[model samples]
Target: MTKKQPKSDATRRRNRVDSSTRQPKPPKSDPNNFHGSNNHHFLAIIAVVFVVSSAISAFLYRRINHPSLPPSFAHQRGLVKEDVTFQEILTENSRVSENVTQRHFTNPVLAYITPWNSAGYDLAKRFCPKFTHLSPVWYDLKSQGTKLVLEGRHNADTGWMSELRLRGNAQILPRVVLEAVPKDLLRSKKQRDKAIDLLITECKDIGYDGIVLESWSRWAAHGVLHDASLRKLALQFVKQLGDSLHNVRSQRNGQPLQLVYVIGPPYSESEKLQAHDFGPEDLRTLSDSVDGFSLMTYDYSSSYSPGPNAPLTWVHSTIKLLVGEGGKSLANKIFVGINFYGNDYVVAEGGGARAITGRDYLSLVDQYKPTMRWQKDFAEHFFVYSDDQHHEHAVFYPTLMSIAERLKEARSWGAGISIWEIGQGLDYFFDLL
Candidate 1:
């Protein structure tokens, strides 16, 4: 009915406007909306990265802070779940009290370590801080044709030395046994010079701090000490070697090389001065030439006697004879030897004694359960046990008390202590040191 009349322009325009208003229009794209979606994606990425980074950081921290023992060391120690005794001992002794004060020694605390026992290697590393000098019984000076040869270079462990240095700044003075003929070496100045040069070269190349010359015993065995002239030559050779070593500077710290002389103790108080044994006079002669005099004060009783390894009286007398009266200054350079091994002797005809380690002692205690006796006079521990064969055996070993008493005596004299070996003793024995 409305279309019947003529349509006006305003009406047409109004209809068109209504149609346009009713039609759906495409929306405009908002930059802010796109930015919000991108932000959410970025946040999700950041969360994932943070989780991964945290895990990595945690792993690294554990590795650096709480490092486990090297697999090789564990293997060398024969560490297994079955060794309950060893494991228990390790667990008990390994935990050091942070509050406990470390023992300080007036003189150098020297320890001898051998390669035959893996225990020595482990103990040396664990107790690196306890020693001022570590003497590895490694090198041997032997006669090779016209030239002097230094053997046992292959036994030098650079990695172990580095680790020892890192743990504690202990000087690495390897024990050098003199296997060369005394007549050939001490008699000829040329040979002596060659030997000194060889030793110096080895110290420089292997980064050794010094050498522990063990020739007095060998010289005594070869009868060099019996001859007064030869003995004088031997002394001169030692002095020369020491002077040369002291003159040369170490590549590691530029410090002069130290020379330690190993000397044997007198057999008895009434022992005559036959020049066969290194005595107190030798100490005085070598006080300036050597850094320290490692006196072998152990082995007072041998396998034949089956007595204490070192009697307190004997040790006291030995120190007294060597240091003399008011000899505090000389005592400072003396490193009295302490035995860590024991002798197990069979109390029967044709029976002999055998050396044993702390582990062996423990096994004996477990199996035999013998009556362990502490001899106050000798300051040692001894026990008699019957094996499965019904054969009686006497074992004489150093107890913690004995070690402590010996240490006290040495300290009173202002003398340093030298452990004959670290491997043969119990884990707790080191506590005395």
Candidate 2:
């Protein structure tokens, strides 16, 4: 509005330029700048940014505190629980069973009996004395007579362990069992020497009080020991026992430590059982070879008892037979037998079919509190029945009451009983004897 200088070209050009054509200001290039250096717009912008930042931070924080689920870890400390945090022990309803925890006597035992054959028995209701009503079978043993052995390799995941991940390992392994092989098959002199060294180390590793060398592992065709080298090697093994970890076993005022060998009577017996004439010499050789004897008295007459009736008399006769007629003191070194389960067989018309047994008969019974009948001579009771399929089944389960009776009998007979095994495979199979 300065009165009109329509003067120069530059001035006219400037005049033609519209003030409205000028560019607005650029945004401030920094995080500090919320809005233009002008109004309350900057304060509103700052507030919005804070809430968004806080939400992202919180989501990230929560993610770090919680993690994944649990898996069974074998290397856990102590008796680990099934499904819980590693730091927490499952102290729920599974308390220690009394059958497993009954009084452990330290009375010097006359003999230690192992139900060796208890290994393979089905422990089904038919075979076991107590569980005739509920057929829960013991799973991981291999028994051949009164002798039993556990090879945790095939057992850790069966029966009570069918579902759980079996995490622990047994005290012994195949290599350990093989370590004690005799000098005959031994190739190198160093190996024979090392067999002694390694066996002692292995035994120490496995917490064994003593070892029972099964005759089946090494025996002569005549059922007597063939290799004098094996006996000599045995002495070396015993020397290791007496000298190494578990010190010398002192039976009478600390005598030399010893190990035992159970030379089984031939597993196969002909219809005409062996008398003193046929097997006595072999028995004598076997007796001379080991510190003691383990006599398997279970499957003699093809039946658990003399009759189909429960608790037939052979249970006592088995012990009586061990004490040869006119013998002064019984073998005094004998460990007798007992069966965890019973047997079943098909009587072929030819009278030649081998008896059916594996104690699998218990699988057929309806054992929901079946009645228990006692037999006096055998000191135990048993059951025999047929399945719907017409297959005959027999069972001999033991309850705590029955086991107590067995213990008493065993003590009177000159020793304590070694339970067929240490397994948790029965429904209520723990001794209700």
Best by lDDT: 1
TM-score of each: 0.76, 0.42
C-alpha RMSD (angstroms) for model 2: 37.6
In terms of TM-score, the best-performing candidate is 1
**What is the C-alpha local distance difference test score of each model?**
0.67, 0.31
Per-residue lDDT value at 189 in model 1: 91
Q: Evaluate residue 146 in candidate 2 and report its C-alpha lDDT on the 0 to 100 scale.
A: 31
RMSD of each candidate? Answer: 36.3, 37.6
User: Pairing residues by index, what is the TM-score of model 2?
Assistant: 0.42
